[model samples]
Target: MADIGGKRVAILATNGFEQSELEVPRDKLREAGAEVHVISLESGEIKGWDLKDWGRTVPVDRVLSDVSADDYDALVLPGGQINPDILRAEPAAIDFIKAFWADKKVIGAICHAPWLLVEAGIIEGRKVTSYHSIKTDVVNAGGKWEDSEVVTDQGLVTSRKPDDLPAFCAKVVEEIGEGRHERRAA
Candidate 1:
Protein backbone atom coordinates (compact mmCIF):
# COMPACT_ATOMS: atom_id res chain seq x y z
CA MET A 1 0.00 0.00 0.00
CA ALA A 2 1.09 3.57 -0.69
CA ASP A 3 2.09 5.51 2.40
CA ILE A 4 -0.14 8.51 2.75
CA GLY A 5 0.09 8.78 6.53
CA GLY A 6 -0.45 12.50 6.70
CA LYS A 7 -2.99 12.86 3.94
CA ARG A 8 -6.68 13.39 4.37
CA VAL A 9 -9.29 12.16 1.88
CA ALA A 10 -12.93 13.03 1.45
CA ILE A 11 -15.52 10.71 -0.07
CA LEU A 12 -18.54 12.66 -1.22
CA ALA A 13 -21.74 10.75 -1.65
CA THR A 14 -25.39 10.66 -0.76
CA ASN A 15 -28.13 8.08 -0.32
CA GLY A 16 -28.11 5.44 -3.05
CA PHE A 17 -24.35 5.28 -3.45
CA GLU A 18 -23.11 1.90 -4.63
CA GLN A 19 -22.24 -0.01 -1.43
CA SER A 20 -19.01 -1.52 -2.63
CA GLU A 21 -17.85 1.55 -4.49
CA LEU A 22 -17.89 3.62 -1.32
CA GLU A 23 -16.82 1.05 1.26
CA VAL A 24 -14.06 -0.66 -0.67
CA PRO A 25 -12.17 2.50 -1.60
CA ARG A 26 -12.72 3.98 1.80
CA ASP A 27 -11.22 0.91 3.43
CA LYS A 28 -8.28 0.78 1.04
CA LEU A 29 -7.47 4.45 1.51
CA ARG A 30 -7.61 4.03 5.25
CA GLU A 31 -5.34 1.03 5.02
CA ALA A 32 -2.88 3.21 3.14
CA GLY A 33 -2.69 5.48 6.22
CA ALA A 34 -4.78 8.37 5.00
CA GLU A 35 -7.53 9.76 7.16
CA VAL A 36 -10.81 9.23 5.31
CA HIS A 37 -14.04 11.07 5.90
CA VAL A 38 -17.47 10.59 4.49
CA ILE A 39 -19.12 13.87 3.57
CA SER A 40 -22.76 13.86 2.71
CA LEU A 41 -25.69 16.15 2.01
CA GLU A 42 -27.13 15.52 5.44
CA SER A 43 -26.11 14.74 8.95
CA GLY A 44 -26.25 11.21 10.40
CA GLU A 45 -25.97 8.18 8.11
CA ILE A 46 -26.62 7.64 4.44
CA LYS A 47 -27.91 4.34 3.08
CA GLY A 48 -26.14 2.59 0.24
CA TRP A 49 -27.54 0.73 -2.74
CA ASP A 50 -26.43 -2.85 -3.12
CA LEU A 51 -26.94 -4.81 -6.34
CA LYS A 52 -30.67 -5.33 -6.19
CA ASP A 53 -31.54 -3.87 -2.85
CA TRP A 54 -30.56 -1.23 -0.30
CA GLY A 55 -27.36 -2.06 1.52
CA ARG A 56 -25.29 -0.76 4.42
CA THR A 57 -25.43 2.67 6.04
CA VAL A 58 -22.34 4.75 6.49
CA PRO A 59 -21.93 7.50 9.01
CA VAL A 60 -21.54 11.03 7.75
CA ASP A 61 -18.34 12.50 9.04
CA ARG A 62 -19.35 15.97 7.99
CA VAL A 63 -22.26 17.65 6.36
CA LEU A 64 -21.71 19.25 2.98
CA SER A 65 -22.73 22.64 4.33
CA ASP A 66 -19.91 22.56 6.86
CA VAL A 67 -17.04 21.43 4.72
CA SER A 68 -14.87 22.85 1.92
CA ALA A 69 -12.48 21.45 -0.62
CA ASP A 70 -9.61 23.04 1.28
CA ASP A 71 -10.10 20.57 4.11
CA TYR A 72 -8.81 17.55 2.24
CA ASP A 73 -5.95 16.43 0.03
CA ALA A 74 -8.10 14.24 -2.20
CA LEU A 75 -11.73 13.59 -3.05
CA VAL A 76 -13.52 10.39 -4.05
CA LEU A 77 -16.88 10.18 -5.75
CA PRO A 78 -18.51 6.75 -5.54
CA GLY A 79 -21.13 6.14 -8.15
CA GLY A 80 -24.65 4.81 -8.01
CA GLN A 81 -27.37 5.66 -10.48
CA ILE A 82 -29.16 7.82 -7.93
CA ASN A 83 -26.24 9.16 -5.91
CA PRO A 84 -24.67 11.23 -8.68
CA ASP A 85 -28.04 12.17 -10.04
CA ILE A 86 -29.03 13.77 -6.75
CA LEU A 87 -25.65 15.36 -6.19
CA ARG A 88 -25.52 16.76 -9.72
CA ALA A 89 -28.72 18.61 -9.04
CA GLU A 90 -27.24 20.20 -5.95
CA PRO A 91 -25.66 23.61 -6.43
CA ALA A 92 -23.39 23.25 -3.41
CA ALA A 93 -22.13 19.84 -4.46
CA ILE A 94 -21.36 21.10 -7.96
CA ASP A 95 -19.48 24.10 -6.58
CA PHE A 96 -17.53 21.96 -4.15
CA ILE A 97 -16.44 19.58 -6.91
CA LYS A 98 -15.45 22.50 -9.13
CA ALA A 99 -13.35 23.92 -6.33
CA PHE A 100 -11.44 20.67 -6.08
CA TRP A 101 -10.84 20.67 -9.84
CA ALA A 102 -9.76 24.30 -9.86
CA ASP A 103 -7.30 23.61 -7.07
CA LYS A 104 -5.95 20.55 -8.87
CA LYS A 105 -6.62 18.21 -5.96
CA VAL A 106 -6.62 14.50 -6.71
CA ILE A 107 -10.11 13.38 -7.66
CA GLY A 108 -11.41 9.83 -8.15
CA ALA A 109 -14.82 9.23 -9.61
CA ILE A 110 -16.04 5.76 -10.44
CA CYS A 111 -19.12 4.55 -12.32
CA HIS A 112 -21.91 7.11 -12.37
CA ALA A 113 -19.93 9.49 -10.18
CA PRO A 114 -18.51 10.99 -13.37
CA TRP A 115 -21.89 12.53 -13.84
CA LEU A 116 -21.00 14.93 -11.10
CA LEU A 117 -17.92 15.88 -13.10
CA VAL A 118 -20.12 16.50 -16.08
CA GLU A 119 -22.39 18.66 -13.96
CA ALA A 120 -19.37 20.56 -12.65
CA GLY A 121 -18.24 21.25 -16.24
CA ILE A 122 -14.73 19.92 -15.67
CA ILE A 123 -14.70 16.95 -18.07
CA GLU A 124 -14.22 18.96 -21.22
CA GLY A 125 -11.31 17.66 -23.28
CA ARG A 126 -10.16 15.25 -20.56
CA LYS A 127 -9.93 11.48 -20.72
CA VAL A 128 -12.44 9.67 -18.52
CA THR A 129 -14.45 6.47 -18.25
CA SER A 130 -17.60 5.54 -16.43
CA TYR A 131 -20.39 2.96 -16.49
CA HIS A 132 -21.45 2.51 -20.10
CA SER A 133 -24.83 4.02 -19.42
CA ILE A 134 -23.20 7.42 -18.97
CA LYS A 135 -20.71 7.26 -21.84
CA THR A 136 -22.71 9.58 -24.03
CA ASP A 137 -23.18 12.09 -21.27
CA VAL A 138 -19.45 12.13 -20.67
CA VAL A 139 -18.64 12.46 -24.37
CA ASN A 140 -21.26 15.14 -24.80
CA ALA A 141 -19.65 16.99 -21.94
CA GLY A 142 -16.37 16.95 -23.94
CA GLY A 143 -14.68 14.11 -22.13
CA LYS A 144 -12.78 11.53 -24.18
CA TRP A 145 -14.74 8.50 -23.08
CA GLU A 146 -12.99 5.14 -23.03
CA ASP A 147 -13.90 1.58 -22.04
CA SER A 148 -10.89 0.91 -19.88
CA GLU A 149 -11.05 -0.35 -16.31
CA VAL A 150 -9.34 2.79 -15.09
CA VAL A 151 -8.31 6.09 -16.65
CA THR A 152 -6.24 8.87 -15.15
CA ASP A 153 -5.67 12.27 -16.70
CA GLN A 154 -3.74 14.85 -14.77
CA GLY A 155 -5.00 14.57 -11.18
CA LEU A 156 -8.32 13.07 -12.17
CA VAL A 157 -9.03 9.33 -11.98
CA THR A 158 -12.07 7.44 -13.24
CA SER A 159 -13.15 3.82 -13.62
CA ARG A 160 -15.87 1.92 -15.38
CA LYS A 161 -17.64 -0.05 -12.65
CA PRO A 162 -17.43 -1.88 -9.31
CA ASP A 163 -15.19 -4.54 -10.82
CA ASP A 164 -12.63 -1.81 -11.44
CA LEU A 165 -12.41 -0.80 -7.77
CA PRO A 166 -8.99 -2.30 -7.18
CA ALA A 167 -7.40 -0.44 -10.05
CA PHE A 168 -9.39 2.68 -9.29
CA CYS A 169 -8.32 2.80 -5.65
CA ALA A 170 -4.69 2.18 -6.54
CA LYS A 171 -4.61 5.01 -9.05
CA VAL A 172 -6.33 7.35 -6.67
CA VAL A 173 -3.69 6.72 -4.04
CA GLU A 174 -0.95 7.12 -6.63
CA GLU A 175 -2.39 10.41 -7.83
CA ILE A 176 -2.78 11.69 -4.29
CA GLY A 177 0.83 10.89 -3.62
CA GLU A 178 1.77 12.78 -6.77
CA GLY A 179 0.17 15.80 -5.12
CA ARG A 180 -1.73 18.55 -6.90
CA HIS A 181 -1.65 18.75 -10.70
CA GLU A 182 -1.35 21.97 -12.65
CA ARG A 183 -4.34 22.01 -14.90
CA ARG A 184 -3.76 23.61 -18.25
CA ALA A 185 -5.65 26.67 -19.31
CA ALA A 186 -8.52 26.14 -21.71
Candidate 2:
Protein backbone atom coordinates (compact mmCIF):
# COMPACT_ATOMS: atom_id res chain seq x y z
CA MET A 1 0.00 0.00 0.00
CA ALA A 2 1.22 3.47 -0.83
CA ASP A 3 1.65 5.63 2.23
CA ILE A 4 0.83 8.93 0.63
CA GLY A 5 1.11 10.88 3.83
CA GLY A 6 0.32 14.56 3.40
CA LYS A 7 -0.92 14.08 -0.15
CA ARG A 8 -4.24 15.73 -0.84
CA VAL A 9 -6.91 13.97 -2.85
CA ALA A 10 -10.25 15.35 -3.88
CA ILE A 11 -13.33 13.25 -4.44
CA LEU A 12 -15.59 15.11 -6.86
CA ALA A 13 -19.16 14.12 -6.37
CA THR A 14 -22.65 15.44 -5.89
CA ASN A 15 -25.96 13.98 -4.81
CA GLY A 16 -26.82 10.62 -6.32
CA PHE A 17 -23.38 9.11 -6.26
CA GLU A 18 -23.13 5.39 -5.84
CA GLN A 19 -22.81 4.80 -2.10
CA SER A 20 -20.06 2.25 -2.15
CA GLU A 21 -18.05 3.78 -4.93
CA LEU A 22 -17.45 7.08 -3.18
CA GLU A 23 -17.33 5.90 0.43
CA VAL A 24 -14.99 3.02 -0.15
CA PRO A 25 -12.39 4.92 -2.08
CA ARG A 26 -12.53 7.87 0.25
CA ASP A 27 -12.02 5.60 3.24
CA LYS A 28 -9.27 3.62 1.58
CA LEU A 29 -7.37 6.72 0.58
CA ARG A 30 -7.69 8.18 4.03
CA GLU A 31 -6.42 4.97 5.52
CA ALA A 32 -3.47 5.04 3.16
CA GLY A 33 -2.46 8.41 4.71
CA ALA A 34 -3.80 10.79 2.12
CA GLU A 35 -5.87 13.78 3.10
CA VAL A 36 -9.15 13.19 1.30
CA HIS A 37 -11.80 15.80 0.78
CA VAL A 38 -15.34 15.30 -0.39
CA ILE A 39 -16.11 18.11 -2.77
CA SER A 40 -19.54 18.76 -4.14
CA LEU A 41 -21.62 21.26 -6.11
CA GLU A 42 -23.13 22.60 -2.93
CA SER A 43 -21.76 23.44 0.47
CA GLY A 44 -24.13 21.15 2.29
CA GLU A 45 -24.01 17.38 2.49
CA ILE A 46 -24.97 15.22 -0.48
CA LYS A 47 -26.97 12.02 -0.41
CA GLY A 48 -25.77 8.83 -2.01
CA TRP A 49 -27.56 6.10 -3.92
CA ASP A 50 -27.17 2.64 -2.51
CA LEU A 51 -27.84 -0.49 -4.52
CA LYS A 52 -31.53 0.33 -4.51
CA ASP A 53 -32.60 3.25 -2.36
CA TRP A 54 -30.93 6.34 -1.05
CA GLY A 55 -28.10 5.72 1.39
CA ARG A 56 -26.22 7.84 3.89
CA THR A 57 -25.20 11.39 3.20
CA VAL A 58 -21.59 12.47 2.96
CA PRO A 59 -20.67 15.90 4.22
CA VAL A 60 -19.05 18.17 1.72
CA ASP A 61 -15.57 19.31 2.55
CA ARG A 62 -15.73 22.09 0.00
CA VAL A 63 -17.92 23.39 -2.76
CA LEU A 64 -16.97 23.39 -6.42
CA SER A 65 -16.62 27.13 -6.61
CA ASP A 66 -14.27 27.15 -3.62
CA VAL A 67 -11.78 24.59 -4.83
CA SER A 68 -8.85 24.93 -7.21
CA ALA A 69 -7.64 21.91 -9.10
CA ASP A 70 -4.05 22.65 -8.26
CA ASP A 71 -4.69 22.20 -4.53
CA TYR A 72 -5.06 18.47 -4.93
CA ASP A 73 -2.76 15.75 -6.20
CA ALA A 74 -5.50 13.43 -7.43
CA LEU A 75 -9.16 13.69 -8.46
CA VAL A 76 -11.65 10.90 -7.96
CA LEU A 77 -15.06 10.68 -9.63
CA PRO A 78 -17.46 8.11 -8.21
CA GLY A 79 -20.17 6.82 -10.49
CA GLY A 80 -23.89 6.44 -10.33
CA GLN A 81 -26.42 7.07 -13.09
CA ILE A 82 -27.51 10.34 -11.52
CA ASN A 83 -24.12 11.45 -10.23
CA PRO A 84 -22.17 11.54 -13.48
CA ASP A 85 -25.16 12.72 -15.45
CA ILE A 86 -25.43 15.80 -13.27
CA LEU A 87 -21.66 16.38 -13.20
CA ARG A 88 -21.25 16.00 -16.95
CA ALA A 89 -23.77 18.76 -17.49
CA GLU A 90 -22.00 21.14 -15.12
CA PRO A 91 -19.42 23.29 -16.87
CA ALA A 92 -17.47 23.85 -13.66
CA ALA A 93 -17.17 20.12 -13.14
CA ILE A 94 -15.92 19.55 -16.65
CA ASP A 95 -13.41 22.36 -16.34
CA PHE A 96 -11.94 20.90 -13.18
CA ILE A 97 -11.57 17.55 -14.88
CA LYS A 98 -9.84 19.19 -17.81
CA ALA A 99 -7.48 21.01 -15.47
CA PHE A 100 -6.49 17.72 -13.89
CA TRP A 101 -5.89 16.15 -17.27
CA ALA A 102 -3.89 19.13 -18.45
CA ASP A 103 -1.62 18.80 -15.44
CA LYS A 104 -1.38 15.04 -15.94
CA LYS A 105 -2.62 14.60 -12.38
CA VAL A 106 -4.12 11.36 -11.26
CA ILE A 107 -7.81 10.99 -12.16
CA GLY A 108 -9.94 8.03 -11.18
CA ALA A 109 -13.42 7.41 -12.51
CA ILE A 110 -15.38 4.32 -11.72
CA CYS A 111 -18.75 3.08 -13.00
CA HIS A 112 -20.60 5.94 -14.73
CA ALA A 113 -18.12 8.51 -13.52
CA PRO A 114 -16.25 8.22 -16.80
CA TRP A 115 -18.99 10.37 -18.26
CA LEU A 116 -17.23 13.38 -16.82
CA LEU A 117 -14.02 12.41 -18.61
CA VAL A 118 -15.91 12.13 -21.86
CA GLU A 119 -17.50 15.51 -21.32
CA ALA A 120 -14.11 17.00 -20.48
CA GLY A 121 -12.81 15.70 -23.85
CA ILE A 122 -9.71 14.13 -22.25
CA ILE A 123 -10.35 10.48 -22.96
CA GLU A 124 -9.64 10.66 -26.66
CA GLY A 125 -7.66 7.56 -27.60
CA ARG A 126 -7.38 6.61 -23.92
CA LYS A 127 -8.29 3.14 -22.81
CA VAL A 128 -11.02 3.09 -20.12
CA THR A 129 -13.88 1.10 -18.68
CA SER A 130 -17.15 1.92 -16.97
CA TYR A 131 -20.54 0.55 -16.10
CA HIS A 132 -21.57 -1.79 -18.88
CA SER A 133 -24.44 0.43 -19.96
CA ILE A 134 -22.15 3.36 -20.70
CA LYS A 135 -19.68 1.46 -22.83
CA THR A 136 -21.12 3.06 -25.94
CA ASP A 137 -20.74 6.54 -24.52
CA VAL A 138 -17.07 5.91 -23.82
CA VAL A 139 -16.49 4.45 -27.28
CA ASN A 140 -18.31 7.24 -29.07
CA ALA A 141 -16.25 9.80 -27.18
CA GLY A 142 -13.03 8.34 -28.72
CA GLY A 143 -12.07 6.20 -25.71
CA LYS A 144 -11.01 2.64 -26.35
CA TRP A 145 -13.55 0.81 -24.21
CA GLU A 146 -12.42 -2.27 -22.33
CA ASP A 147 -14.30 -4.76 -20.19
CA SER A 148 -12.30 -5.09 -17.03
CA GLU A 149 -12.42 -4.68 -13.28
CA VAL A 150 -9.93 -1.86 -13.53
CA VAL A 151 -8.06 -0.10 -16.32
CA THR A 152 -5.26 2.39 -15.92
CA ASP A 153 -4.22 4.51 -18.88
CA GLN A 154 -1.56 7.04 -18.18
CA GLY A 155 -2.59 8.39 -14.77
CA LEU A 156 -6.27 7.74 -15.39
CA VAL A 157 -7.88 4.89 -13.45
CA THR A 158 -11.31 3.50 -14.25
CA SER A 159 -13.39 0.55 -13.14
CA ARG A 160 -16.58 -1.15 -14.14
CA LYS A 161 -18.75 -1.12 -11.03
CA PRO A 162 -18.98 -1.34 -7.24
CA ASP A 163 -17.76 -4.92 -7.35
CA ASP A 164 -14.51 -3.58 -8.72
CA LEU A 165 -14.01 -1.04 -5.95
CA PRO A 166 -11.09 -2.86 -4.35
CA ALA A 167 -9.06 -2.78 -7.53
CA PHE A 168 -10.17 0.74 -8.34
CA CYS A 169 -9.13 2.10 -4.96
CA ALA A 170 -5.73 0.43 -5.13
CA LYS A 171 -5.00 1.83 -8.54
CA VAL A 172 -5.95 5.31 -7.37
CA VAL A 173 -3.40 5.07 -4.58
CA GLU A 174 -0.70 3.71 -6.84
CA GLU A 175 -1.26 6.47 -9.35
CA ILE A 176 -1.18 9.06 -6.59
CA GLY A 177 2.13 7.71 -5.33
CA GLU A 178 3.56 7.92 -8.83
CA GLY A 179 2.66 11.61 -8.89
CA ARG A 180 1.96 13.47 -12.13
CA HIS A 181 2.30 11.51 -15.33
CA GLU A 182 3.98 12.62 -18.56
CA ARG A 183 0.95 12.10 -20.73
CA ARG A 184 0.13 14.60 -23.48
CA ALA A 185 -1.64 17.59 -22.03
CA ALA A 186 -5.23 18.09 -22.95
Candidate 3:
Protein backbone atom coordinates (compact mmCIF):
# COMPACT_ATOMS: atom_id res chain seq x y z
CA MET A 1 0.00 0.00 0.00
CA ALA A 2 1.02 3.61 -0.55
CA ASP A 3 2.42 5.63 2.32
CA ILE A 4 -0.27 8.28 2.48
CA GLY A 5 0.11 8.77 6.20
CA GLY A 6 -0.62 12.31 7.45
CA LYS A 7 -1.80 13.48 4.06
CA ARG A 8 -4.99 15.48 3.84
CA VAL A 9 -7.51 14.81 1.07
CA ALA A 10 -10.26 17.25 0.27
CA ILE A 11 -13.39 15.83 -1.35
CA LEU A 12 -15.42 18.52 -3.07
CA ALA A 13 -19.03 17.70 -3.79
CA THR A 14 -22.60 18.48 -2.82
CA ASN A 15 -26.03 16.98 -2.35
CA GLY A 16 -27.10 14.24 -4.78
CA PHE A 17 -23.52 12.98 -5.14
CA GLU A 18 -23.16 9.36 -6.24
CA GLN A 19 -23.07 7.46 -2.97
CA SER A 20 -20.54 4.79 -3.95
CA GLU A 21 -18.38 7.26 -5.82
CA LEU A 22 -17.93 9.30 -2.67
CA GLU A 23 -18.14 6.77 0.14
CA VAL A 24 -16.08 3.91 -1.27
CA PRO A 25 -13.06 5.98 -2.21
CA ARG A 26 -13.31 8.11 0.89
CA ASP A 27 -13.31 5.07 3.14
CA LYS A 28 -10.45 3.47 1.27
CA LEU A 29 -8.33 6.61 1.30
CA ARG A 30 -8.96 7.12 4.99
CA GLU A 31 -7.99 3.58 5.74
CA ALA A 32 -4.79 4.19 3.79
CA GLY A 33 -4.05 7.04 6.26
CA ALA A 34 -5.25 10.20 4.56
CA GLU A 35 -7.31 12.63 6.59
CA VAL A 36 -10.35 13.25 4.40
CA HIS A 37 -12.45 16.37 4.50
CA VAL A 38 -15.70 16.76 2.60
CA ILE A 39 -16.23 20.32 1.46
CA SER A 40 -19.52 21.36 -0.04
CA LEU A 41 -21.41 24.43 -1.24
CA GLU A 42 -23.72 24.47 1.73
CA SER A 43 -23.64 23.95 5.44
CA GLY A 44 -25.01 20.97 7.39
CA GLU A 45 -25.14 17.63 5.57
CA ILE A 46 -25.24 16.78 1.89
CA LYS A 47 -27.36 13.86 0.76
CA GLY A 48 -25.97 11.03 -1.38
CA TRP A 49 -27.52 9.04 -4.23
CA ASP A 50 -27.16 5.30 -3.91
CA LEU A 51 -27.25 2.93 -6.88
CA LYS A 52 -30.90 3.49 -7.66
CA ASP A 53 -32.15 5.92 -5.06
CA TRP A 54 -31.30 8.26 -2.21
CA GLY A 55 -28.82 6.97 0.32
CA ARG A 56 -26.68 8.38 3.15
CA THR A 57 -26.12 11.96 4.24
CA VAL A 58 -22.51 13.02 4.64
CA PRO A 59 -21.65 16.04 6.77
CA VAL A 60 -19.93 18.91 5.08
CA ASP A 61 -16.56 19.81 6.57
CA ARG A 62 -16.56 23.37 5.29
CA VAL A 63 -18.14 25.52 2.61
CA LEU A 64 -16.35 25.89 -0.72
CA SER A 65 -16.13 29.60 -0.09
CA ASP A 66 -14.07 28.99 3.04
CA VAL A 67 -11.55 26.35 2.05
CA SER A 68 -8.04 26.85 0.62
CA ALA A 69 -6.14 24.71 -1.84
CA ASP A 70 -2.87 24.92 0.06
CA ASP A 71 -4.36 23.16 3.05
CA TYR A 72 -4.59 19.75 1.44
CA ASP A 73 -2.48 17.22 -0.41
CA ALA A 74 -5.14 16.25 -2.93
CA LEU A 75 -8.63 17.07 -4.20
CA VAL A 76 -11.31 14.49 -4.98
CA LEU A 77 -14.48 15.03 -7.00
CA PRO A 78 -17.02 12.26 -6.65
CA GLY A 79 -19.52 12.28 -9.46
CA GLY A 80 -23.23 11.82 -9.92
CA GLN A 81 -25.05 13.45 -12.81
CA ILE A 82 -26.53 16.09 -10.54
CA ASN A 83 -23.60 16.68 -8.22
CA PRO A 84 -21.04 17.96 -10.71
CA ASP A 85 -23.78 19.54 -12.80
CA ILE A 86 -24.73 21.79 -9.91
CA LEU A 87 -21.14 22.34 -8.81
CA ARG A 88 -20.01 23.34 -12.29
CA ALA A 89 -22.61 26.07 -12.25
CA GLU A 90 -21.20 27.44 -9.03
CA PRO A 91 -18.33 29.87 -9.55
CA ALA A 92 -16.94 29.11 -6.12
CA ALA A 93 -16.75 25.40 -6.80
CA ILE A 94 -15.13 26.02 -10.17
CA ASP A 95 -12.59 28.31 -8.54
CA PHE A 96 -11.79 25.67 -5.93
CA ILE A 97 -11.01 23.14 -8.65
CA LYS A 98 -8.86 25.68 -10.48
CA ALA A 99 -6.92 26.51 -7.37
CA PHE A 100 -6.15 22.87 -6.67
CA TRP A 101 -4.67 22.48 -10.13
CA ALA A 102 -2.73 25.72 -9.92
CA ASP A 103 -1.13 24.41 -6.76
CA LYS A 104 -0.10 21.23 -8.60
CA LYS A 105 -1.80 19.01 -6.09
CA VAL A 106 -3.19 15.62 -6.99
CA ILE A 107 -6.71 15.84 -8.43
CA GLY A 108 -9.05 12.87 -8.78
CA ALA A 109 -12.30 13.09 -10.71
CA ILE A 110 -14.46 10.03 -11.28
CA CYS A 111 -17.42 9.60 -13.66
CA HIS A 112 -19.13 12.91 -14.46
CA ALA A 113 -16.99 14.68 -11.91
CA PRO A 114 -14.73 15.73 -14.80
CA TRP A 115 -17.46 18.22 -15.59
CA LEU A 116 -16.03 20.31 -12.81
CA LEU A 117 -12.61 20.18 -14.46
CA VAL A 118 -14.13 21.30 -17.74
CA GLU A 119 -15.96 24.11 -15.98
CA ALA A 120 -12.73 25.21 -14.34
CA GLY A 121 -11.05 25.46 -17.76
CA ILE A 122 -8.20 23.17 -16.69
CA ILE A 123 -8.90 20.29 -19.05
CA GLU A 124 -7.18 21.73 -22.08
CA GLY A 125 -4.35 19.57 -23.38
CA ARG A 126 -4.72 17.08 -20.56
CA LYS A 127 -5.50 13.43 -20.97
CA VAL A 128 -8.41 12.15 -18.88
CA THR A 129 -11.05 9.45 -18.60
CA SER A 130 -14.59 9.77 -17.37
CA TYR A 131 -18.00 8.16 -17.62
CA HIS A 132 -18.59 7.18 -21.24
CA SER A 133 -21.39 9.68 -21.75
CA ILE A 134 -19.18 12.63 -20.86
CA LYS A 135 -16.27 11.76 -23.11
CA THR A 136 -17.52 14.14 -25.75
CA ASP A 137 -17.63 17.02 -23.33
CA VAL A 138 -14.13 16.22 -22.14
CA VAL A 139 -12.84 16.10 -25.72
CA ASN A 140 -14.65 19.28 -26.63
CA ALA A 141 -12.97 20.95 -23.68
CA GLY A 142 -9.59 20.03 -25.31
CA GLY A 143 -8.83 17.06 -23.14
CA LYS A 144 -7.56 13.89 -24.74
CA TRP A 145 -10.26 11.57 -23.52
CA GLU A 146 -9.82 7.81 -23.10
CA ASP A 147 -12.01 4.80 -22.34
CA SER A 148 -9.69 3.20 -19.80
CA GLU A 149 -10.91 2.26 -16.34
CA VAL A 150 -8.52 4.84 -14.93
CA VAL A 151 -6.27 7.41 -16.62
CA THR A 152 -3.52 9.41 -14.95
CA ASP A 153 -1.94 12.26 -16.80
CA GLN A 154 0.35 14.80 -15.22
CA GLY A 155 -0.99 14.96 -11.66
CA LEU A 156 -4.62 14.13 -12.25
CA VAL A 157 -6.21 10.69 -11.97
CA THR A 158 -9.60 10.07 -13.53
CA SER A 159 -11.81 7.02 -13.76
CA ARG A 160 -14.71 5.94 -15.95
CA LYS A 161 -17.33 4.73 -13.49
CA PRO A 162 -18.25 3.29 -10.12
CA ASP A 163 -16.88 -0.09 -11.17
CA ASP A 164 -13.44 1.51 -11.42
CA LEU A 165 -13.49 2.46 -7.76
CA PRO A 166 -10.79 0.00 -6.67
CA ALA A 167 -8.25 1.22 -9.22
CA PHE A 168 -9.36 4.81 -8.66
CA CYS A 169 -8.88 4.64 -4.91
CA ALA A 170 -5.51 2.92 -5.25
CA LYS A 171 -4.21 5.60 -7.57
CA VAL A 172 -5.39 8.37 -5.28
CA VAL A 173 -3.60 6.82 -2.36
CA GLU A 174 -0.47 6.48 -4.50
CA GLU A 175 -0.55 10.07 -5.69
CA ILE A 176 -1.20 11.52 -2.26
CA GLY A 177 1.74 9.58 -0.93
CA GLU A 178 3.99 10.85 -3.70
CA GLY A 179 3.61 14.41 -2.27
CA ARG A 180 6.02 15.95 -4.77
CA HIS A 181 5.27 16.48 -8.41
CA GLU A 182 8.57 15.08 -9.67
CA ARG A 183 8.21 11.95 -7.57
CA ARG A 184 4.64 11.55 -8.79
CA ALA A 185 5.81 11.71 -12.40
CA ALA A 186 8.28 8.91 -11.97
lDDT per residue as tens, model 2, 26-105: 99999999999999999989999998999999999999999989999999999999999999999999999999988889
- Which residue runs of candidate 3 sit more than 4 Å off their true CA positions? 182-186
Kindly indicate the candidate among 1 and 2 with the higher TM-score: 1
For candidate 3, list the clashing residue pairs, or say none.
none
Which rank order by lDDT, best down to worst? 1, 2, 3
Task: Give the C-alpha lDDT of model 2.
Answer: 0.94
Considering every candidate listed, which one attains the maximal lDDT?
1
Misplaced by over 4 Å in model 1 are none
Backbone collisions counted per model: 0, 0, 0
| Model 2 spans with C-alpha error above 4 angstroms | none
Against the hidden reference, what TM-scores do the models get? 0.98, 0.98, 0.95
Distance (Å) between predicted and true CA of 5, model 1? 0.9
lDDT of 1 by residue, 90-131 (tens): 999999999999899999999999999999999999999999
- Model 3 earns a TM-score of 0.95
Error of 1 at 34 (Å): 0.5
lDDT of 3 at 95: 85
